[model samples]
Target: MALSTAPGPPPPGLSAAKIVAYLHGPEPYLLIPDPTPGTHQALVRWLQGRQAVAGPVVARTDAGASLRWARTLLALTPQWPGTAGELLFVEDHLAKVVLFQDPLLAGHLSAKWLGRLSDMTPRQRERMEQTLLAWLEGGGAAEAAQLLRIHPQTVRYRLRKLERIFGGSLRTPQARFEILLALKIHGMAAECARLRHRAEELPARAASEPRRDARSIGR
Candidate 1:
């Protein structure tokens, strides 16, 4: 796979038959031999048709590395701002990918920054954590309020509470960085947990659903 900046259909000279496309499990993959800008254009069109989101197309020199890179991008999809079906590229989120590449490291950081806050009730902790992240990312109470869809006064209230819990550490650059990263990691972790629960229920869901015969469906 090769990365191309162009977006649209394949050039007239590029034959669709040359691109080998197939579905592996729930993902659709394409193998374009001697992939060029035109090939990538075609791929963009194909993905758009299916309303799919994908990772950056990596070099084929190491198939294993390519697969791993793709999986990493997919795992971090929850952190991205795009809605379902938008074509998002890994290039846009390289920093986050590196920051969260190691779950053990991310978990450690999350614990370090959030351990005290976790002692609070689940709902309160959630609100505080979200407020902290919004404040850090937005840089002010008004901006944070817009992000959280809450009143500016409410944001100030949470910030005051967070300041008491976190103390002057929130004033420091390094602590703020760690807190932001930890909060983001926590969000992604929650998404992963939900996906796991859904996967575990997949078999039961399939069994519970009625199946139709191929012939009967066509009749």
Candidate 2:
């Protein structure tokens, strides 16, 4: 589950004050103090929002466990000076629990990982996503073309373009994993964005449209 550091309600019956008290109570002593609050805050934010540990129990040591988990995960992250990020893939949290953070893994996955998609024409990027997904689905040009509803020649041509863009990564196992996983994550994020957009429109939609006469609107 995704973790959040936004300081929400703690487990039920657990005094809000108790949780609040611990929030500032040396949030698990850092392995090293971040030079600025950014990096540290990044880590703390990453740690937040996990499914509440079972509630109403005082025998827990979650504060320390969370720190330990953070240390374990963040320890693998490479520090890019002056950059403001240390992202954790909550989707991969369970599968990647023993996994150390990969500071640059996003790069291996897609151009969009670092907003590099902005460099590509929209059509080019769209084609790239289609081709990459088909490629990872593990097939030759004919199969990819079938999946994309395009000509085999088109698939092969796009593959060539992708080769230029991604180098030998299409053939590299680890790189393939990163690319496929990243694409899945990117797709999930986009879907979430669409949902949120629709949600945002709901309030406006209601306000702009006529209110229903309940009796006439439904049985």
Candidate 3:
């Protein structure tokens, strides 16, 4: 089937019509096109090989299917220095899949969620962060209240505020799972940054140390 190279809508053609119809369906179907002669074919073969090992087999076709497949893949993958929409799309998708594949990956996804939470008011963010830390360190409401130096009822109030901020639906098991995941991610990133700063200071610290052994050797 002939493909359209037009900037606007796809030209009236069987391939374009078929693709439009396929996209409207629920079951995921990737439309990959045959590679052009020479360089393109080699690249296509390489991509095909890579995809073979990643997960499920995506189908190939000649009607702009490969472009759609690539767009979808890129959309699902993380992007830096780009639109928030792209980042959010990738974060959401990764949260769904990465948790199943790698525990560490879940932490990274959670960090992205925390990044979103950072946009909230400072008071709200502080309350939630304190609550989360207390919950993690202490486990139960009583312990959390002790850590925060607040009464149990006050702790409950703060938690309820957090629940409202996070939304009532998120108070459930699955939602809490995501919230915990995000908190871990944020904590890991903070720890990593702290470690990195300490490492950077080491060289300066080493340089500033007195050369006692050198002076003794010279004498």
The top-ranked prediction according to TM-score is 1
lDDT of 1 by residue, 78-139 (tens): 32122223455556767666767787898999999899886799999989988999999999
Could you give candidate 2's per-residue lDDT for residues 10-96 as a string of tens digits?
343333223332344323232222123554344445434331111111224554544545544433333332234434532345333
lDDT of 3 by residue, 115-149 (tens): 55667788887677878668656877899999999
Better of 1 and 3 by lDDT: 1
**TM-score, one value per model:** 0.63, 0.50, 0.42
Clashing pairs in 1: none
Query: In order, how many clashes per candidate?
Result: 0, 6, 7
Where does candidate 3 stray beyond 4 Å?
1-108, 120-127, 136-140, 147-149, 210-219
Q: Which 10 successive residues of model 2 have the least lDDT summed? A: 50-59
Candidate 1, residue 48: the lDDT equals: 50
Q: Residue 188 lDDT in model 2?
A: 48
- The lDDT for every candidate, in the order shown, is 0.69, 0.52, 0.49
Q: Which candidate, 1 or 2, would have the higher lDDT against the true structure? A: 1
**Which of 2 and 3 is ahead in lDDT?**
2
Residue 116's lDDT within candidate 2 is 41
Best by the lDDT measure? 1
